[model samples]
Target: MRIHLDTGRSGEKLAAEWLSQRGYTILACNWKYGRKEIDIIASLDNILHFIEVKTRRGHGFGMPEEQVTRKKLKNIKTAAEAYLETFPQWRRVQFDIVSIIYAPGGHNIQLLEDIS
Candidate 1:
């Protein structure tokens, strides 16, 4: 099934809002490098966080977090390195994942943080 981009963007927005409420300050959204994209770059205190957001309409395929394979992690790491170069002041760097499972028949959003 092909996922619609508008729906995906809405999910990302919801995930960002949830993170912001948890004290995370968002630095970038949809930051890309070549073919890879980092959904959210955020900071909490002094730690710079490279975050990936995955969304699913249902659990038929798998949990959203399960989609982040090792290869995908590698891409995120590479893209993050490029991202950090822009902010040399940040010494602490970390990676995180936020899974958003939208309600099967509605707009409800559920979030899981730091899965990676």
Candidate 2:
């Protein structure tokens, strides 16, 4: 059987729905600003959340959260700043990473929040 890696997109979709179920208003997904892309942008109670979604099949390689490097964090921060500039009314903001581990059988997916 052939297994294709569409982890990034799948993770983002899962994260968005997860947030929505918790009452977050999703403002954007896969938002691109120049060369940077934010996986999910959401707000709840006037607090903005900039999210990064990481997905892996298992720990055979490494944990999904381990993929976010310092440079990647820096880029996400810069992108958040740019996003904030466009919506200064946001009272608070936070950065979060959603780690998803999906099994090969398409079941037993687990989500870890704020891994960063």
Candidate 3:
């Protein structure tokens, strides 16, 4: 349980850096609404992004993005709605997923935008 938590935290950190390099300024990380959490929230081109970061040590189970289920998406959407209420300045919003595959040599990251 602890290992998974650690990996998730690490993946979120990596995702923040990756987004920063690509012109996204991270606003909040691990931000929550009720019981849901947004891994990374960023802004670019006047659009606010709510990101979910999934990490995996191997592909034996599946790709990181594959783990984002319908229920998870629903929760994320609800969380985004709540977040939007607090940050009304950001009228344009996007839902994104950052999948990280952490392996021996290095890590592979994939960003899927506008999932919502």
- Superposing every Cα of model 2 onto the true structure, what RMSD results? 2.9
Candidate numbers, best TM-score first, in rank order: 3, 1, 2
Model 3, residue 15: distance off in Å is: 0.5
Which 10 consecutive positions of candidate 2 have the poorest summed lDDT?
107-116
**lDDT per residue (tens digit) for residues 1-116 in model 3:** 99999999999999999999999999999899988988888999999999999999989889999989999999988998999898888879999999999999999999998987
Assess candidate 3 and give its lDDT. 0.92
lDDT, candidate 1, 1-116, per-residue tens: 34667657877898899889989999999999889899999999899888887777777778878888999999998998888787788898888877777775664454544545
Report backbone clashes per prediction.
0, 0, 0
Model 3 clash count equals 0
TM-score of each predicted structure versus truth: 0.85, 0.85, 0.96
Root-mean-square deviation per candidate: 2.3, 2.9, 0.8
Give the runs in model 1 whose Cα sits over 4 Å from its true position.
104-116
Q: lDDT (CA) for every model shown?
A: 0.81, 0.80, 0.92
Query: Tens digits of per-residue lDDT for model 2 on 1-116?
Result: 13434666777788789789989899999888899989899988887888888887777888887888999988888998998899899877888887777877663334444444
Q: Between 2 and 3, whose TM-score is larger?
A: 3
Model 3, runs deviating above 4 Å:
none
Candidate 1 vs candidate 3: the lDDT winner is 3
